[model samples]
Target: MTGSPTHEPWEVYALKYTRNDKPRRMDVMLGEGGSTDPMPMDYFIWVLCRGSRTVLVDLGFHAQVAARRNRVLLRTPLEALATMDLHPANIDDIVITHLHFDHAGGIDQFPDTPIHLQASEMAFATGACMAMPAIGGFYEEDDVKELVRKLFRGQLTLHEGDDVLEPGLSVHWIGGHTGGTQVIRVWTRRGWLVLASDASHYFVNVLQRRPFMWTYNVGDHLLGFERLLALADSTDHLIPGHDPLVMEQYPPPCADLQGIVARLDADPLFSVHDRIPVQAGR
Candidate 1:
Protein backbone atom coordinates (compact mmCIF):
# COMPACT_ATOMS: atom_id res chain seq x y z
CA MET A 1 0.00 0.00 0.00
CA THR A 2 1.13 3.63 -0.61
CA GLY A 3 0.18 4.33 2.97
CA SER A 4 -2.67 6.90 3.36
CA PRO A 5 -4.26 8.00 0.10
CA THR A 6 -4.13 11.69 -0.74
CA HIS A 7 -7.61 12.21 0.63
CA GLU A 8 -6.99 10.29 3.85
CA PRO A 9 -5.71 12.26 6.84
CA TRP A 10 -1.94 12.34 7.38
CA GLU A 11 -0.31 11.69 10.75
CA VAL A 12 2.88 13.25 12.26
CA TYR A 13 4.28 12.37 15.66
CA ALA A 14 6.57 14.59 17.82
CA LEU A 15 8.83 12.22 19.75
CA LYS A 16 10.43 14.04 22.67
CA TYR A 17 14.20 14.16 23.02
CA THR A 18 16.02 16.44 25.48
CA ARG A 19 13.72 19.02 27.06
CA ASN A 20 15.99 21.21 29.18
CA ASP A 21 17.73 24.53 29.92
CA LYS A 22 19.92 25.67 27.03
CA PRO A 23 16.91 26.04 24.77
CA ARG A 24 15.00 27.79 27.51
CA ARG A 25 17.78 30.39 27.77
CA MET A 26 17.76 30.82 24.01
CA ASP A 27 14.05 31.58 24.14
CA VAL A 28 14.60 34.09 26.92
CA MET A 29 17.26 35.89 24.91
CA LEU A 30 14.91 36.08 21.93
CA GLY A 31 11.78 37.10 23.80
CA GLU A 32 12.84 39.09 26.85
CA GLY A 33 16.52 39.83 26.53
CA GLY A 34 17.43 37.38 29.33
CA SER A 35 14.52 38.32 31.55
CA THR A 36 12.96 35.53 33.56
CA ASP A 37 10.05 33.74 31.97
CA PRO A 38 8.29 30.40 32.28
CA MET A 39 9.53 29.12 28.92
CA PRO A 40 11.16 25.67 28.79
CA MET A 41 13.06 23.83 26.06
CA ASP A 42 11.16 21.10 24.20
CA TYR A 43 13.00 19.01 21.61
CA PHE A 44 11.29 16.41 19.44
CA ILE A 45 11.51 13.83 16.68
CA TRP A 46 8.97 14.97 14.09
CA VAL A 47 7.74 11.62 12.74
CA LEU A 48 5.58 11.80 9.63
CA CYS A 49 3.68 9.28 7.51
CA ARG A 50 2.93 5.63 8.37
CA GLY A 51 2.70 2.15 6.84
CA SER A 52 5.38 1.14 4.33
CA ARG A 53 7.26 4.42 4.74
CA THR A 54 7.90 6.41 7.92
CA VAL A 55 9.65 9.79 7.82
CA LEU A 56 11.35 11.54 10.73
CA VAL A 57 12.33 15.21 10.74
CA ASP A 58 15.38 15.96 12.94
CA LEU A 59 16.23 13.24 15.46
CA GLY A 60 16.47 14.63 18.99
CA PHE A 61 19.75 14.73 20.95
CA HIS A 62 21.40 11.48 21.93
CA ALA A 63 21.94 10.61 25.61
CA GLN A 64 25.74 10.87 25.42
CA VAL A 65 25.57 14.29 23.78
CA ALA A 66 25.06 15.99 27.16
CA ALA A 67 27.87 14.17 28.87
CA ARG A 68 30.15 14.76 25.90
CA ARG A 69 29.44 18.48 26.20
CA ASN A 70 29.84 18.29 29.98
CA ARG A 71 26.12 18.85 30.60
CA VAL A 72 23.28 16.79 31.99
CA LEU A 73 20.84 14.78 29.89
CA LEU A 74 17.65 16.43 31.02
CA ARG A 75 15.79 14.39 28.43
CA THR A 76 17.38 11.53 26.53
CA PRO A 77 16.23 10.83 22.96
CA LEU A 78 16.01 7.07 23.49
CA GLU A 79 13.89 7.47 26.61
CA ALA A 80 11.61 9.79 24.70
CA LEU A 81 11.29 7.26 21.88
CA ALA A 82 10.42 4.60 24.42
CA THR A 83 7.51 6.75 25.62
CA MET A 84 5.96 6.15 22.19
CA ASP A 85 7.23 2.56 21.91
CA LEU A 86 9.31 3.53 18.86
CA HIS A 87 12.68 1.89 18.42
CA PRO A 88 15.55 3.37 16.43
CA ALA A 89 15.17 0.66 13.78
CA ASN A 90 11.48 1.55 13.26
CA ILE A 91 12.37 4.77 11.46
CA ASP A 92 12.56 4.21 7.68
CA ASP A 93 13.61 7.69 6.56
CA ILE A 94 15.12 10.78 8.22
CA VAL A 95 15.28 14.38 6.97
CA ILE A 96 18.23 16.04 8.64
CA THR A 97 17.56 19.80 8.63
CA HIS A 98 21.19 20.59 9.34
CA LEU A 99 24.22 18.87 10.85
CA HIS A 100 24.13 20.60 14.21
CA PHE A 101 25.04 18.15 16.98
CA ASP A 102 21.66 18.39 18.72
CA HIS A 103 19.54 17.73 15.63
CA ALA A 104 21.74 15.17 13.90
CA GLY A 105 23.47 13.30 16.73
CA GLY A 106 20.93 10.51 17.18
CA ILE A 107 21.09 9.45 13.52
CA ASP A 108 23.62 6.65 14.07
CA GLN A 109 21.22 5.02 16.48
CA PHE A 110 19.06 4.17 13.47
CA PRO A 111 21.62 2.20 11.51
CA ASP A 112 19.43 1.22 8.55
CA THR A 113 17.40 4.38 8.13
CA PRO A 114 17.91 6.36 4.94
CA ILE A 115 18.77 10.02 5.69
CA HIS A 116 18.06 13.09 3.54
CA LEU A 117 20.04 16.33 3.70
CA GLN A 118 20.84 19.28 1.47
CA ALA A 119 23.92 18.97 -0.71
CA SER A 120 25.31 22.28 0.52
CA GLU A 121 25.36 20.95 4.09
CA MET A 122 27.61 18.13 3.01
CA ALA A 123 30.01 20.66 1.49
CA PHE A 124 29.94 22.85 4.57
CA ALA A 125 30.78 19.96 6.86
CA THR A 126 33.57 18.68 4.64
CA GLY A 127 34.98 22.05 3.65
CA ALA A 128 37.22 24.53 5.49
CA CYS A 129 34.47 25.34 8.01
CA MET A 130 35.06 22.10 9.87
CA ALA A 131 38.74 23.03 10.22
CA MET A 132 38.03 26.60 11.36
CA PRO A 133 37.73 26.64 15.13
CA ALA A 134 35.10 29.40 15.15
CA ILE A 135 32.54 27.67 12.92
CA GLY A 136 33.53 24.29 14.28
CA GLY A 137 31.90 25.18 17.59
CA PHE A 138 28.50 24.62 16.02
CA TYR A 139 29.30 21.10 14.83
CA GLU A 140 30.68 17.97 16.43
CA GLU A 141 33.37 16.41 14.25
CA ASP A 142 32.80 12.93 15.62
CA ASP A 143 29.06 13.02 14.91
CA VAL A 144 29.55 14.35 11.37
CA LYS A 145 32.26 11.77 10.73
CA GLU A 146 29.67 9.10 11.45
CA LEU A 147 27.19 10.79 9.08
CA VAL A 148 29.86 10.85 6.37
CA ARG A 149 30.29 7.11 6.84
CA LYS A 150 26.54 6.70 6.38
CA LEU A 151 26.72 8.67 3.15
CA PHE A 152 29.44 6.36 1.85
CA ARG A 153 27.27 3.41 2.80
CA GLY A 154 24.40 4.86 0.70
CA GLN A 155 22.30 5.46 3.78
CA LEU A 156 22.33 9.22 3.15
CA THR A 157 20.58 10.92 0.24
CA LEU A 158 21.75 14.40 -0.72
CA HIS A 159 19.30 16.87 -2.30
CA GLU A 160 20.57 19.86 -4.28
CA GLY A 161 17.55 22.12 -4.57
CA ASP A 162 13.80 22.20 -4.12
CA ASP A 163 12.42 18.71 -4.61
CA VAL A 164 9.35 16.72 -3.74
CA LEU A 165 9.92 13.50 -1.82
CA GLU A 166 6.29 12.50 -2.24
CA PRO A 167 3.05 14.18 -3.24
CA GLY A 168 2.42 16.96 -0.71
CA LEU A 169 5.80 16.32 0.91
CA SER A 170 8.63 18.51 -0.30
CA VAL A 171 12.05 19.80 0.80
CA HIS A 172 13.00 23.43 0.18
CA TRP A 173 16.58 24.71 0.43
CA ILE A 174 16.50 27.55 2.97
CA GLY A 175 20.09 27.93 4.13
CA GLY A 176 20.86 30.59 6.73
CA HIS A 177 21.45 29.20 10.18
CA THR A 178 23.99 27.04 8.41
CA GLY A 179 25.25 26.78 4.86
CA GLY A 180 22.76 23.98 4.07
CA THR A 181 19.67 24.35 6.25
CA GLN A 182 16.32 23.32 4.77
CA VAL A 183 12.67 23.06 5.77
CA ILE A 184 10.12 20.27 5.27
CA ARG A 185 6.58 21.12 4.20
CA VAL A 186 3.75 18.62 4.37
CA TRP A 187 0.05 18.70 3.58
CA THR A 188 -1.67 18.24 6.92
CA ARG A 189 -5.30 18.15 8.10
CA ARG A 190 -4.90 21.70 9.39
CA GLY A 191 -3.42 22.79 6.05
CA TRP A 192 0.26 23.06 5.09
CA LEU A 193 2.59 22.10 7.93
CA VAL A 194 6.05 23.57 7.52
CA LEU A 195 8.69 22.14 9.82
CA ALA A 196 11.04 25.09 10.33
CA SER A 197 13.91 23.01 11.59
CA ASP A 198 16.70 25.39 12.67
CA ALA A 199 15.73 27.81 9.91
CA SER A 200 14.30 29.62 12.90
CA HIS A 201 14.90 27.93 16.25
CA TYR A 202 12.44 30.01 18.22
CA PHE A 203 8.99 31.41 17.39
CA VAL A 204 10.27 34.85 18.35
CA ASN A 205 12.70 34.63 15.47
CA VAL A 206 9.64 34.76 13.21
CA LEU A 207 7.55 37.08 15.37
CA GLN A 208 10.24 39.73 15.59
CA ARG A 209 11.55 39.05 12.11
CA ARG A 210 15.00 38.72 13.65
CA PRO A 211 17.64 36.27 12.56
CA PHE A 212 19.15 34.04 15.19
CA MET A 213 22.76 34.76 16.21
CA TRP A 214 24.27 31.52 14.89
CA THR A 215 23.51 32.26 11.24
CA TYR A 216 26.22 32.06 8.57
CA ASN A 217 24.46 34.64 6.41
CA VAL A 218 22.02 36.85 8.26
CA GLY A 219 20.53 37.96 4.94
CA ASP A 220 19.80 34.40 3.81
CA HIS A 221 18.62 33.53 7.29
CA LEU A 222 16.11 36.37 7.24
CA LEU A 223 15.03 35.48 3.72
CA GLY A 224 14.60 31.82 4.66
CA PHE A 225 12.07 32.78 7.32
CA GLU A 226 10.08 34.75 4.74
CA ARG A 227 10.14 31.82 2.35
CA LEU A 228 9.04 29.43 5.10
CA LEU A 229 6.26 31.79 6.19
CA ALA A 230 5.05 31.99 2.62
CA LEU A 231 4.95 28.20 2.42
CA ALA A 232 3.00 27.81 5.67
CA ASP A 233 -0.76 28.41 5.66
CA SER A 234 -0.31 30.31 8.92
CA THR A 235 2.39 31.02 11.47
CA ASP A 236 0.95 28.39 13.79
CA HIS A 237 1.37 25.83 11.06
CA LEU A 238 5.05 26.73 10.85
CA ILE A 239 6.63 24.82 13.73
CA PRO A 240 9.96 26.13 14.98
CA GLY A 241 12.95 23.83 15.46
CA HIS A 242 13.23 24.36 19.26
CA ASP A 243 10.35 26.40 20.66
CA PRO A 244 8.98 25.31 24.05
CA LEU A 245 5.54 26.72 23.23
CA VAL A 246 5.14 23.91 20.71
CA MET A 247 4.66 21.35 23.47
CA GLU A 248 1.67 23.22 24.89
CA GLN A 249 0.09 24.00 21.53
CA TYR A 250 -0.02 20.70 19.64
CA PRO A 251 -2.30 17.85 20.70
CA PRO A 252 -0.77 15.00 22.68
CA PRO A 253 0.14 11.71 21.01
CA CYS A 254 -2.09 8.64 20.90
CA ALA A 255 -2.08 6.24 23.85
CA ASP A 256 0.36 3.36 23.42
CA LEU A 257 3.91 2.61 24.37
CA GLN A 258 4.65 6.04 22.86
CA GLY A 259 1.63 8.05 23.99
CA ILE A 260 3.57 11.31 24.30
CA VAL A 261 4.36 11.17 20.61
CA ALA A 262 2.12 13.80 19.03
CA ARG A 263 -0.66 12.59 16.73
CA LEU A 264 -0.60 14.68 13.54
CA ASP A 265 -4.16 13.67 12.59
CA ALA A 266 -5.50 15.91 15.34
CA ASP A 267 -6.33 19.50 14.43
CA PRO A 268 -4.41 22.25 16.19
CA LEU A 269 -6.12 25.21 17.84
CA PHE A 270 -4.61 27.80 15.58
CA SER A 271 -4.61 31.55 16.18
CA VAL A 272 -5.11 34.29 13.62
CA HIS A 273 -2.14 36.21 15.02
CA ASP A 274 -0.08 33.13 14.24
CA ARG A 275 -0.16 34.18 10.61
CA ILE A 276 3.28 35.13 9.38
CA PRO A 277 3.65 38.83 8.81
CA VAL A 278 5.00 40.17 5.51
CA GLN A 279 8.76 39.70 5.23
CA ALA A 280 10.26 42.77 6.87
CA GLY A 281 13.39 43.17 4.74
CA ARG A 282 11.85 41.91 1.53
Candidate 2:
Protein backbone atom coordinates (compact mmCIF):
# COMPACT_ATOMS: atom_id res chain seq x y z
CA MET A 1 0.00 0.00 0.00
CA THR A 2 3.02 2.27 0.01
CA GLY A 3 3.10 3.62 -3.57
CA SER A 4 2.70 2.35 -7.11
CA PRO A 5 3.26 3.54 -10.69
CA THR A 6 3.18 0.27 -12.60
CA HIS A 7 2.19 -2.36 -10.07
CA GLU A 8 0.17 -2.73 -6.87
CA PRO A 9 -2.35 -0.01 -7.50
CA TRP A 10 -4.35 1.57 -4.72
CA GLU A 11 -7.95 0.69 -3.91
CA VAL A 12 -10.34 3.24 -5.45
CA TYR A 13 -13.98 3.24 -4.51
CA ALA A 14 -16.79 5.33 -5.95
CA LEU A 15 -19.32 6.06 -3.21
CA LYS A 16 -22.40 6.79 -5.30
CA TYR A 17 -25.65 8.55 -4.36
CA THR A 18 -29.06 8.38 -5.93
CA ARG A 19 -30.18 11.68 -7.38
CA ASN A 20 -33.87 10.87 -7.59
CA ASP A 21 -34.82 13.89 -9.65
CA LYS A 22 -36.02 14.67 -13.14
CA PRO A 23 -33.82 16.30 -15.74
CA ARG A 24 -34.78 19.58 -17.42
CA ARG A 25 -34.20 19.87 -21.12
CA MET A 26 -31.82 22.69 -22.19
CA ASP A 27 -30.28 22.70 -18.75
CA VAL A 28 -26.52 23.20 -18.63
CA MET A 29 -26.10 19.48 -18.14
CA LEU A 30 -27.34 18.77 -21.64
CA GLY A 31 -25.07 18.45 -24.66
CA GLU A 32 -25.69 20.55 -27.82
CA GLY A 33 -28.51 18.25 -28.79
CA GLY A 34 -28.45 16.18 -25.65
CA SER A 35 -31.02 13.42 -25.72
CA THR A 36 -34.56 14.48 -24.93
CA ASP A 37 -35.09 11.06 -23.44
CA PRO A 38 -34.51 11.96 -19.79
CA MET A 39 -30.81 12.44 -18.99
CA PRO A 40 -29.73 10.12 -16.18
CA MET A 41 -27.48 11.67 -13.52
CA ASP A 42 -26.11 10.51 -10.18
CA TYR A 43 -23.79 11.94 -7.52
CA PHE A 44 -20.58 10.39 -6.26
CA ILE A 45 -17.50 11.11 -4.16
CA TRP A 46 -14.53 8.78 -4.51
CA VAL A 47 -12.30 7.22 -1.85
CA LEU A 48 -8.71 6.13 -2.47
CA CYS A 49 -6.45 4.06 -0.26
CA ARG A 50 -3.02 2.55 -0.76
CA GLY A 51 -2.12 1.17 2.68
CA SER A 52 -2.00 3.93 5.31
CA ARG A 53 -2.90 6.95 3.25
CA THR A 54 -6.63 7.32 2.69
CA VAL A 55 -7.78 10.12 0.37
CA LEU A 56 -11.34 11.28 -0.21
CA VAL A 57 -12.33 13.14 -3.33
CA ASP A 58 -15.01 15.84 -3.51
CA LEU A 59 -17.16 15.90 -0.40
CA GLY A 60 -20.81 16.00 -1.51
CA PHE A 61 -23.61 18.42 -0.62
CA HIS A 62 -25.22 18.12 2.78
CA ALA A 63 -28.87 17.20 3.40
CA GLN A 64 -29.86 20.74 4.28
CA VAL A 65 -28.37 22.05 1.07
CA ALA A 66 -30.16 19.35 -0.86
CA ALA A 67 -33.46 20.31 0.70
CA ARG A 68 -32.88 23.99 -0.02
CA ARG A 69 -31.92 23.26 -3.62
CA ASN A 70 -34.91 20.95 -4.00
CA ARG A 71 -32.70 18.00 -4.82
CA VAL A 72 -33.00 14.63 -3.16
CA LEU A 73 -30.26 13.58 -0.77
CA LEU A 74 -30.45 9.90 0.04
CA ARG A 75 -27.38 10.07 2.30
CA THR A 76 -24.66 12.53 3.09
CA PRO A 77 -21.23 11.66 1.74
CA LEU A 78 -19.95 11.30 5.30
CA GLU A 79 -22.84 9.04 6.18
CA ALA A 80 -22.14 6.93 3.09
CA LEU A 81 -18.51 6.57 4.20
CA ALA A 82 -19.66 5.48 7.64
CA THR A 83 -21.38 2.52 6.00
CA MET A 84 -17.92 1.44 4.86
CA ASP A 85 -16.38 2.09 8.29
CA LEU A 86 -14.43 5.09 6.96
CA HIS A 87 -15.04 8.04 9.23
CA PRO A 88 -14.24 11.60 8.27
CA ALA A 89 -11.46 11.79 10.85
CA ASN A 90 -9.67 8.84 9.28
CA ILE A 91 -9.33 10.62 5.94
CA ASP A 92 -5.71 11.78 5.51
CA ASP A 93 -6.27 14.12 2.60
CA ILE A 94 -9.39 15.69 1.11
CA VAL A 95 -9.16 16.75 -2.52
CA ILE A 96 -11.52 19.44 -3.79
CA THR A 97 -12.16 18.59 -7.43
CA HIS A 98 -13.75 22.00 -7.90
CA LEU A 99 -15.45 24.63 -5.78
CA HIS A 100 -18.97 23.93 -7.05
CA PHE A 101 -21.50 23.41 -4.28
CA ASP A 102 -22.10 19.70 -4.91
CA HIS A 103 -18.38 18.97 -5.05
CA ALA A 104 -17.17 21.31 -2.32
CA GLY A 105 -20.04 21.41 0.23
CA GLY A 106 -18.54 19.29 3.04
CA ILE A 107 -15.80 21.66 4.19
CA ASP A 108 -16.77 21.26 7.84
CA GLN A 109 -16.97 17.46 7.56
CA PHE A 110 -13.24 16.77 7.44
CA PRO A 111 -11.86 19.15 10.04
CA ASP A 112 -8.09 19.82 9.85
CA THR A 113 -7.53 17.40 6.95
CA PRO A 114 -5.16 19.23 4.61
CA ILE A 115 -7.22 20.00 1.46
CA HIS A 116 -5.67 19.84 -2.00
CA LEU A 117 -6.88 21.87 -5.01
CA GLN A 118 -5.82 24.13 -7.85
CA ALA A 119 -4.99 27.69 -6.71
CA SER A 120 -6.75 29.28 -9.67
CA GLU A 121 -10.06 27.73 -8.59
CA MET A 122 -9.95 29.70 -5.36
CA ALA A 123 -9.40 32.86 -7.33
CA PHE A 124 -12.28 32.10 -9.66
CA ALA A 125 -14.58 31.52 -6.70
CA THR A 126 -13.67 34.85 -5.13
CA GLY A 127 -12.89 37.03 -8.10
CA ALA A 128 -15.11 39.18 -10.33
CA CYS A 129 -16.22 36.25 -12.43
CA MET A 130 -18.72 35.61 -9.66
CA ALA A 131 -20.53 38.78 -10.64
CA MET A 132 -21.48 37.11 -13.88
CA PRO A 133 -24.55 34.99 -13.29
CA ALA A 134 -23.76 32.56 -16.08
CA ILE A 135 -20.49 31.68 -14.40
CA GLY A 136 -21.38 32.02 -10.72
CA GLY A 137 -24.85 30.51 -10.84
CA PHE A 138 -23.57 27.00 -10.21
CA TYR A 139 -21.74 27.93 -6.97
CA GLU A 140 -23.38 28.46 -3.63
CA GLU A 141 -22.19 31.57 -1.76
CA ASP A 142 -22.05 29.74 1.56
CA ASP A 143 -19.67 27.08 0.25
CA VAL A 144 -17.25 29.69 -1.07
CA LYS A 145 -17.37 31.49 2.28
CA GLU A 146 -16.46 28.31 4.13
CA LEU A 147 -13.52 27.69 1.80
CA VAL A 148 -12.34 31.23 2.49
CA ARG A 149 -12.57 30.52 6.20
CA LYS A 150 -10.42 27.41 5.75
CA LEU A 151 -7.89 29.46 3.83
CA PHE A 152 -7.63 31.94 6.72
CA ARG A 153 -7.13 29.08 9.18
CA GLY A 154 -4.22 27.86 7.02
CA GLN A 155 -5.80 24.40 6.68
CA LEU A 156 -5.90 24.36 2.89
CA THR A 157 -3.08 23.15 0.61
CA LEU A 158 -3.47 24.66 -2.83
CA HIS A 159 -1.68 23.33 -5.93
CA GLU A 160 -0.97 25.03 -9.22
CA GLY A 161 -0.99 23.22 -12.60
CA ASP A 162 -0.26 19.55 -11.75
CA ASP A 163 1.15 18.05 -8.54
CA VAL A 164 1.90 14.69 -7.03
CA LEU A 165 0.30 14.23 -3.62
CA GLU A 166 2.08 10.93 -3.06
CA PRO A 167 4.14 8.39 -5.03
CA GLY A 168 1.17 6.94 -6.91
CA LEU A 169 -1.44 9.69 -6.62
CA SER A 170 -1.43 12.98 -8.49
CA VAL A 171 -3.80 15.74 -9.68
CA HIS A 172 -3.86 17.63 -12.94
CA TRP A 173 -5.40 21.08 -13.42
CA ILE A 174 -7.72 20.27 -16.36
CA GLY A 175 -9.67 23.58 -16.20
CA GLY A 176 -12.82 22.81 -18.19
CA HIS A 177 -16.05 22.56 -16.25
CA THR A 178 -14.55 25.16 -13.95
CA GLY A 179 -11.70 27.50 -14.63
CA GLY A 180 -9.64 25.70 -11.98
CA THR A 181 -11.06 22.19 -12.21
CA GLN A 182 -8.63 19.31 -11.80
CA VAL A 183 -8.76 15.50 -12.11
CA ILE A 184 -7.12 12.86 -9.94
CA ARG A 185 -4.84 10.11 -11.28
CA VAL A 186 -4.00 7.05 -9.20
CA TRP A 187 -2.15 3.80 -9.75
CA THR A 188 -4.50 0.95 -8.99
CA ARG A 189 -4.24 -2.85 -9.16
CA ARG A 190 -5.72 -2.57 -12.66
CA GLY A 191 -3.20 0.03 -13.78
CA TRP A 192 -3.15 3.84 -13.80
CA LEU A 193 -6.69 5.18 -13.32
CA VAL A 194 -8.10 8.70 -13.33
CA LEU A 195 -11.03 10.07 -11.39
CA ALA A 196 -12.27 12.59 -13.92
CA SER A 197 -14.09 14.63 -11.32
CA ASP A 198 -16.06 17.19 -13.34
CA ALA A 199 -13.72 17.08 -16.29
CA SER A 200 -16.19 14.68 -17.84
CA HIS A 201 -19.32 14.19 -15.75
CA TYR A 202 -20.54 11.37 -18.00
CA PHE A 203 -18.78 8.88 -20.28
CA VAL A 204 -20.59 10.35 -23.28
CA ASN A 205 -19.09 13.72 -22.46
CA VAL A 206 -15.82 12.14 -23.51
CA LEU A 207 -16.60 9.28 -25.87
CA GLN A 208 -19.35 10.98 -27.86
CA ARG A 209 -17.66 14.40 -27.81
CA ARG A 210 -20.67 15.87 -26.02
CA PRO A 211 -19.89 18.78 -23.72
CA PHE A 212 -21.68 19.55 -20.50
CA MET A 213 -23.15 23.05 -20.99
CA TRP A 214 -21.93 24.58 -17.71
CA THR A 215 -18.28 24.61 -18.70
CA TYR A 216 -15.88 27.50 -18.22
CA ASN A 217 -13.98 26.79 -21.43
CA VAL A 218 -15.36 24.52 -24.12
CA GLY A 219 -11.90 24.01 -25.59
CA ASP A 220 -10.50 22.99 -22.24
CA HIS A 221 -13.47 20.70 -21.56
CA LEU A 222 -12.87 18.80 -24.79
CA LEU A 223 -9.14 18.83 -24.10
CA GLY A 224 -9.73 17.42 -20.63
CA PHE A 225 -11.49 14.42 -22.17
CA GLU A 226 -8.52 13.70 -24.38
CA ARG A 227 -6.19 14.29 -21.48
CA LEU A 228 -8.02 11.70 -19.41
CA LEU A 229 -7.82 9.19 -22.25
CA ALA A 230 -4.07 9.71 -22.47
CA LEU A 231 -3.34 9.79 -18.73
CA ALA A 232 -5.27 6.65 -17.94
CA ASP A 233 -3.68 3.27 -18.65
CA SER A 234 -6.73 2.73 -20.88
CA THR A 235 -10.16 4.21 -21.58
CA ASP A 236 -11.68 1.61 -19.25
CA HIS A 237 -9.56 2.91 -16.38
CA LEU A 238 -10.97 6.44 -16.45
CA ILE A 239 -13.82 7.17 -14.04
CA PRO A 240 -16.22 9.95 -14.85
CA GLY A 241 -17.47 12.16 -12.03
CA HIS A 242 -21.23 11.62 -12.24
CA ASP A 243 -22.01 8.67 -14.52
CA PRO A 244 -24.60 6.16 -13.28
CA LEU A 245 -22.99 3.54 -15.49
CA VAL A 246 -20.08 3.47 -13.04
CA MET A 247 -22.10 1.60 -10.46
CA GLU A 248 -23.62 -0.75 -13.05
CA GLN A 249 -20.25 -1.53 -14.63
CA TYR A 250 -18.05 -2.22 -11.60
CA PRO A 251 -19.06 -4.58 -8.83
CA PRO A 252 -19.33 -3.28 -5.31
CA PRO A 253 -16.35 -3.66 -2.98
CA CYS A 254 -18.36 -5.98 -0.72
CA ALA A 255 -21.50 -8.05 -1.02
CA ASP A 256 -23.48 -6.27 1.66
CA LEU A 257 -23.06 -2.83 0.09
CA GLN A 258 -24.19 -3.58 -3.41
CA GLY A 259 -24.32 -0.54 -5.79
CA ILE A 260 -23.04 1.75 -3.04
CA VAL A 261 -19.31 1.08 -3.41
CA ALA A 262 -17.35 0.02 -6.52
CA ARG A 263 -13.86 -1.48 -6.58
CA LEU A 264 -11.41 0.13 -9.00
CA ASP A 265 -8.57 -2.34 -8.43
CA ALA A 266 -9.98 -4.68 -11.05
CA ASP A 267 -10.84 -4.63 -14.75
CA PRO A 268 -14.16 -3.28 -15.96
CA LEU A 269 -16.84 -5.90 -16.68
CA PHE A 270 -18.97 -3.97 -19.23
CA SER A 271 -17.77 -3.06 -22.66
CA VAL A 272 -17.86 0.64 -23.51
CA HIS A 273 -20.45 1.42 -26.20
CA ASP A 274 -18.63 2.88 -29.20
CA ARG A 275 -21.50 4.62 -30.96
CA ILE A 276 -19.56 7.73 -31.86
CA PRO A 277 -18.14 7.38 -35.34
CA VAL A 278 -15.38 9.97 -35.16
CA GLN A 279 -12.16 9.45 -33.27
CA ALA A 280 -11.03 11.97 -30.65
CA GLY A 281 -8.76 14.74 -31.84
CA ARG A 282 -5.55 14.69 -29.88
**What are the candidates' C-alpha RMSDs?**
4.0, 2.7
Root mean square deviation (Cα) for candidate 2: 2.7
Give the number of the best model, judged by TM-score: 2
lDDT of 2: 0.82
lDDT of 2 by residue, 10-77 (tens): 89999976565466466645446444566678899889987788999998898888888888877888
Give me the overall lDDT of model 1.
0.74
- Give the residue spans of candidate 2 off by over 4 A: 1-8, 24-31, 274-278
Model 1 per-residue lDDT at 48: 84
For candidate 1, the per-residue lDDT at 110 reads 84
What is the C-alpha local distance difference test score of each model? Answer: 0.74, 0.82
